[model samples]
Target: MKARITVMRTVGAAVMAGALAWGVVTGAQTDTPPQDASVEAVADAAPGYAVEDYNYPQADKILAEKNIVLKRGDGHIVLADCASETGLLEVWARSRDKICFKVTGNSGWLTLEIPSVYGVKGSADQTAQVDMTVGSEEKSFDVAKNSFAAVGESADEQGRDYMLVEIRTAK
Candidate 1:
């Protein structure tokens, strides 16, 4: 009788452990809590800023429209190619002839690069200013994060443009 009791207890423990493990796996796969509806509504209102697909021309045009040039020198365009290859969405904005980009991916990393003609100044907590020209446009911008703004409508000081890129991994 004692032997049978011990066998039943062992089976009960195994079943409970299996149930607990299944619950954990399933919970992890469940969707995250819904985001704020107001935020979603605002996002819906701004379709132009949306990043739906990442395929060449579409991606290239999106960046170009904002006067952003990716992969100017060599190496890689950083997030540009990765965003396209991985089908992630990104946005670019040009302020004062400088380019600022932000990317949000389904998984992995998001990167931004800003070129500085005079190189970045100070530390991350400090502000950095850069001057440059895009075509006939002259501009200057103060970079708080990884961004670039032009100084004025003038030929690139060094006759070459510089860029700073930032990448962040998504959860």
Candidate 2:
């Protein structure tokens, strides 16, 4: 009877230890939280705004400082200080003696404004056409390569004030 009792007590202890180990493993596994199936959008995933690279640089500053309403231009034509370089397309005005543009490449076009220009001097090897405006009238003139040409008020019969508006050049 004594031996049988000891055997039964040993069996009971084994069963209790097995139950405790199983409980510990299950409790450890349940510590991880569950994930939901619902989806949601986030604000940072949207696209960002950007500026166009082709737009002219410092255009607003140029307008404010020069009093020039330079709208746009092909990269081939650009502003220059007079006599700084050769083969410039020069705008001679009644107010300012000259405004210069460095003309390069074989062909180019620019839209700009010099309030009272009356003459244009062409690049060394390229012919240019200039557009001018006076009141309600618009006119165009062709300038020869490497030479001066009358435009704006100089080309007018009544010699009215005129604004230089455009220039297109070709080799």
Predicted candidate 1 versus true structure: per-residue lDDT over 23-115, tens digit per residue: 998876866655763334565675557754433333466567754444232221233342333322222223443232223322222233344
Cand. 1 TM to true fold = 0.22
Pairs in steric clash, model 2: none
TM-score of 2: 0.66
Error of 1 at 37 (Å): 52
Scanning candidate 1 in windows of ten residues, the lowest lDDT window is 71-80
In candidate 1, stretches whose alpha carbon ends up further than 4 angstroms from where it belongs are 1-57, 70-107, 110-113, 117-162
Runs of candidate 2 exceeding 4 Å displacement: 1-55
Write down the lDDT of every candidate, Cα atoms only.
0.41, 0.84
Query: Model 2: per-residue lDDT, tens digit, 1-171?
Result: 999999999999999999999999877677445586454579647888995454456778888887667667777777788869887888899866688888888898778878888889998878999988888889999999889998888888899888888889999
